[model samples]
Target: MNAFTRQLPKLMLALTALQLSAPALAQVKAPADSSNQVVVPQVDRRDVRLPRFPSNDFEAGLFGGAFSTQNFGASAVGGLRVGYHITEDWFVEAALGRTTVSDEAFTRVLPGGIFTPGNEKLQYANLSAAVNLLPGEVFFGRDNAKPSSVFLIGGVGTTKFNGQRQQGFNLGVGMKVFLRDWAAVRIDMRDHIFSVDLLGKRETTHNLELSTGVSFFF
Candidate 1:
């Protein structure tokens, strides 16, 4: 009987320990499951954007000037220039003009000695590229008001004196006073350097010109 009682107490204590250990094991297993179920955040990628550049426009103008030769007489001259704007500050121009002078001295030495008065007419044409030292708007003004701008021109072309052809180079420095948006008045000092064949005499001539004209820009 005593043995049975002792065995019963021992069996009850074993059962109590088993019950406590079972709850602790269950708690540990629950924590492990929670750690595995934790969520990780995901990141998204995006594309970058950039800005665009500006575009420039085209422009043109017309002008004229007076000319004088070294050995020949001096006279007033007129001309037209057509230009294309390669940039805001640069252009290419083609110019054509005419001048008239008196050759009384040359006529006096004629063989007939009949006192012939000589009258000579001259014409010239040039193609040159010009660069604006300042912005065209600075001289011609903007949408608000008119202004004045300065520029320089240089080029190589041909000039005709009577029936003879001469290869030449032209240079000019000028300024434009803008009266309106599309129209402006310009004055420039131009030099024409050329080699001429005068009566089989190869001579170099410098033609200096002072001119004023109007320009229309588009």
Candidate 2:
């Protein structure tokens, strides 16, 4: 009986140890599962904005206005301008045009005492540099929008009439109303300062012009 009792206690101790060791093994496997599990962070993308495109390039247009000269009479002036963009805000423009001026209708007595009427016509061509005070996008708007822009121009060129030539300076301000991405209508006002020699005497003339035209860009 004593031997059986001692053996039974030994068996109980072994079973208890086995129960404790089994829980420790389960704890090890639990940590292994936790290590294998992954937590991934979700990411979100944001929209990026880009800079606007510039309008520096080639352009062409036609313009007309009224003009008066010292030697010539008052007339209508018409011209065409071809321009190249030198920078984002500057351009070089060349123009070729003609002005037809008429003399004031006054009764003039000739050496033979006969009444006569006099008339005169003159033509001119000019070149100029223009500075854009606003960006092209501001004038033409975004890729699919409409806007308005203003510009100032100054230039020096020559005018020829009836085998006579005069040098002059042109100062102007213009506004462009953009109708589309590559087209606009423009209006401009200018003052021309010129000098001429009449009968061996020098004379100064100031001519004012108001003009409207179509501007095309590529």
What lDDT does the true structure give each of the candidates? 0.75, 0.74
- All candidates: CA RMSD in angstroms? 10.6, 9.1
Q: Which stretches of candidate 1 lie over 4 Å from their true place?
A: 1-64, 107-117, 135-145
Candidate 1 TM-score, true structure as reference: 0.63
Off by over 4 Å in 2: 1-56, 70-73, 105-118, 134-145
lDDT of 1 by residue, 106-134 (tens): 65675533223355567778898888896
lDDT of each residue in 1-218, candidate 2, tens digit only: 99998799899999999998997787774335677789987978789999888563888999887775554445778888888878867888887777765444332423422112344445556789999896454423346656777889989888775457889888999888788767878888887877766446677777777788998988
Per-residue error (Å), model 2, residue 7: 19
- Model 2 residue 122 CA deviation (Å) reads 2.3
Please name the candidate that would achieve the greatest lDDT relative to the true structure.
1
Pairs in clash, predicted candidate 1: 65-211, 66-210, 139-147, 139-148, 139-149, 141-147
